[model samples]
Target: MKYSSKNAQETEKLGKKLVSKLRGGETIALTGDLGSGKTVFAKGVAKALGIRKKITSPTFVLWRLYQIPKPGRIKYLCHIDLYRLTQSQDILALGINEYWQRKDTVCLIEWAEKIKRFLPRKNLFLVKFEISDLNTRKIIIDGVSDVRS
Candidate 1:
């Protein structure tokens, strides 16, 4: 489905909408340009997941793991950023692939195009973001209904 966010707040609201639908072992591939509100959307999802820590893009750290606490659909959130790595080997070296193998974790990846070849073809949500205007973002979500365990 397609969604339009007039500002960062709206973008986060869209992200929040996806949280309840996530089950463990789900991977989310997010693609967008520099200022496309990808992080904002992620923050929204984190908020809905009952995470209290500040959400930041894991560009420098490469990846960040958050516990979803108790009474949630998923136990963990593996947020990854592949923008810094150009080689697939580097991605593999960081053990990034291991996140998808966990049955109790939900992963959200930014700059997912960088590791497109490494992403799973099934049970994934591909989110594409476009800067439609100075303050508006066009978000497209695919494969949501097709997500399987």
Candidate 2:
């Protein structure tokens, strides 16, 4: 569905809420302009996964892996950023694609439009953000049931 956030905090809250239904092996494609709250939403998901480390976009290094502190079936969080790459080959060398289907890991990719063709056809979530004025955002989520529930 879709959601409107009045500010960063609200956007993050929505992110945490959306992630509650994830059980791992899920890939989330987060897309939007810079400073559109993609990273903030990711932090919310990280918080729900019991990750304590600060969450930051992997724009330079390309990807960051975090271990779920209280691991159960979901043991890892793989966060990737493709903002710096104009071509898919630049990202393929990172071998980050292997995380797409790992049962114990949840993959979140920012600027996923860079490699949309390479993503799994199923079990994927697309979170799109749009700037709505200076402190607001319109977020749309697809590929699953209503996150509002």
Candidate 3:
């Protein structure tokens, strides 16, 4: 579905709503330009997942893992940033496929266009963002998942 947000806050709210529907073993592919608010949207997802720690763009680190505490459970959220990688082999070396195989983790990949070939056809959520104005963004979300507001 398509969602329009007047500002980053609105975009994040949309992200949070989408996150509430997510289960473990899900993958979300995010594609957008620089400063398109992909990281802001991700912070919303983290919050929805009961993560209280600070969230930041993993540009320099490439990947960051967050643990969320739920009732009688712990959920793993792996956030990956592929902005600086120059080769697909770099991604492969990170053992991303291992995380993909796990049924107890959710992976959110930024700059997913860089590694599209490695992603599974099914069980993937694609979120694309475009800057419509100085403070507005047109976000398009596509997948077969149900997201409740």
68-111 per-residue lDDT for model 2 (tens digits): 98998889999999999888867778877667669999999999
Top lDDT model: 2
Residue 84 of model 1, lDDT score: 91
Write the residue-wise lDDT of candidate 3 on 14-97 in tens digits.
Answer: 879987667677888999998888999899888888889888878877988887778223278899989998896688877666
- Steric clash pairs (candidate 2): none
TM for candidate 2 is: 0.95
For 60-116, candidate 1 gives per-residue lDDT tens digits of 889999988674558888889888977866877876666664778889999999888
* Candidate 3 TM-score versus the reference: 0.91
Q: How many residue pairs clash in model 3? A: 0
Model 3: per-residue Cα lDDT at residue 59: 82
Residue 9 displacement (Å), model 1? 0.9
- The list of candidate 3 runs beyond 4 A from truth reads 71-74, 145-149
Q: What is the TM-score of each candidate against the true structure?
A: 0.92, 0.95, 0.91
Off by over 4 Å in 1: 145-149
